[model samples]
Target: MVAGTVSGTAEWSRPRATHAEVTVGFGTDDTTVQVRSVTTTVANRTELTLANALVDTRLQFLTAGEADDLSVAADGRTRTYDRTVTVTVTLYAGDQDTETVAADVPVEIVVTNEPGNSEESGGSNAGAT
Candidate 1:
């Protein structure tokens, strides 16, 4: 993870994606507590903890990458279009006053393209005389 600066204040904002996909997590930290929630501000300050208050989740990103696209058949009456999906993970401290931390987590995004449908020809049954 790289130490950087963030600007904004949000209790629950969308995660940041690196190469199209967005993922959020903490830095090199490990804990046993489970994250309850996360909060952030325009200044890019995140705070998080655990609901149980036992241990910290120590949120952090493992890995991230791009996924494949979905495929669809196109019809003559309708048109085909391309679509994509991005995924990301966020680390939370599980505290109301705490903010959400961001890291480069592993994620996959899918892109799909719709194709046209094919027409069928008229035919008789083989048993028909």
Candidate 2:
């Protein structure tokens, strides 16, 4: 695929009352993807963000302690000492786009810090021992 900042909105073809799966990858740290919450069953449109909806995996080789020293950008605010997380979204399921009718759905990704480590240094000071 392409490697760059993933922004903007993409459309997916998902059916009604169905769930879609998404996976995300982070940098060379213990960062991970998480879905805080989701609003999937009420409106025809589903809204997802860092606060809700996330990748379905975690980071290895990165210690749980070190992960506590992560940060994510959200709503023009810098979230420090947060969970390094990523997000993936399934716009639709099948084919929401047809020559006859077309529908474009949108999803949001919000990065934030994870809560757990209450006394660890916010990392960011990697040098040497």
Candidate 3:
């Protein structure tokens, strides 16, 4: 198992062997993120699974604001949202044979809204013209 950290706006890439590459993307709500493996080792026969605090049993990306909203709801405040995601890769080596690797990745979702600069911070114009 491997452990690491990633940001919401970045992609994490892990290369295995000489021709296998694992890429993970934390896409925005409007973006379609797909987990795929390009490898010559197993002829592209690979399965990817992504599990996190907000997702499970599948590989997918959270929406742009989804993580931030979840963090706020969980703690009544949001600034830097943090979550742990686990990625599992299963490679089919041959008939009835396979190899699996798991990684525990920490993700940091940055809330772009700056305090005192947004209405949510009770700015002077919060309720005024």
Candidate 4:
């Protein structure tokens, strides 16, 4: 995540990723998240842009067989799993030709299973009829 500030400000504010292209790459798939391309905007803040960008790239690295293997079910309900993926984010300055910074970042994603409401069970529910 890119953060910046002008300083000398009382209240802190979240830095915006402006004037740059965020490129996420996983294996052979690569996708660029533009500043203006956002899934949702709340109070002028972009939501899920970075997250969606990362997921899109990660999906390319998975094959049909690999995806099927990763899916699992427990107690007749699918369970979510966490996977750590290595990705590279390239930051450009003004233009793609001008590469200002690049880094390999590890992204952890929670892969959700099929839609189902799961009931919580444990010590308290052990003896409940």
Candidate 5:
């Protein structure tokens, strides 16, 4: 998460994309509790965790490097993966005076290896269909 991006009285829902590779936020309104930020604490795909730059779910396609790192074979230079992630989310109260509550949220990660869809390209291997 950015230094000053998520530290303040949020007038509206502010989504913070942090190490979790998901938007974690804390905000509120008059009705039900609102969700702002979601941080993935654990992921099956460890390589795409905090050490990585790409956010979970947000990027539904794996770059060549990512596939190589995951050792996920590319079928016809294309492939897709589905994984689960454990995340922490914040629930905000309608009354700003009330302290924001933290909640647990589950996240699903899906990615398709599309050619020329990532930042860089290099790992080009063939896999059986």
Candidate 6:
């Protein structure tokens, strides 16, 4: 099985819709290899369910007071953080639940602070008075 990488950016002050290129695959191209379930370790961070896209996934950029500390780059203009997200998928054969395959893939999440990217723009208020 294989999974794609995830990269996202947010402002240090506000939240934004998370972004990522998520892809899941199997070793064998079996038509019956359907996905029974999909989950991620960043479910809470992304505020989303791996099940469907019905809900919104807003990201809270690496703020203060968290297990992972924020990294300041370019002299405090940008704050970044790295996180590992595990995407687990359960596959089953068509019309049969007994034959199931489970796979876990760890994807890295790099969230950096972008300048001027707010609701007004994207996530920055630098130009604001």
TM-score per candidate, chains pooled: 0.18, 0.26, 0.36, 0.27, 0.23, 0.25
Per-residue lDDT of 71 in model 6: 38
lDDT per residue (tens digit) for residues 1-129 in model 3: 112333232122332322223445443344424443333343442333232221322444454455334432322234564555544344443443245555656566554332234466664321110
Candidate 3, after superposition: displacement of residue 117 in Å?
Answer: 8.1
Model 1 spans > 4 angstroms off: 1-46, 49-102, 118-129
What's the candidate order when arranged by decreasing TM-score? Answer: 3, 4, 2, 6, 5, 1
Model 5 over residues 79-114: C-alpha lDDT tens digits?
Answer: 333332222332222322222223333333333444
What is candidate 2's CA lDDT for residue 102? 20
Stretches of candidate 6 exceeding 4 Å from the true structure: 1-64, 77-80, 91-129
Provide the lowest-lDDT 10-residue window in model 2.
97-106
Q: Candidate 2: lDDT over CA atoms?
A: 0.33
Q: What is the lDDT of residue 119 in candidate 5?
A: 36
Model 2 lDDT, residue 70, Cα: 43
How many Å off is the CA of 113 in candidate 5? 14
Q: Is candidate 1 or candidate 4 better by lDDT?
A: 4
Clashes of 4: 0
Q: Over 4 Å off in model 2, which ranges?
A: 1-17, 28-43, 54-61, 64-86, 92-129
Candidate 4: worst-modelled 10 consecutive residues by lDDT: 3-12
| Per-residue lDDT of candidate 6, residues 1-129 (tens digit) | 122332232112212322322223322222222222233232213233343431223323223443233333432254333333333322222322221222343333343434444595554544211
C-alpha lDDT of residue 44 in model 6: 16
**What's the C-alpha lDDT at position 77 in model 2?**
47
**Highest TM-score against the true fold, candidate:** 3
Clashes (candidate 5): 6
User: What 10-residue stretch in candidate 1 is worst by lDDT?
Assistant: 61-70
TM-score preference between candidates 2 and 4, better one: 4
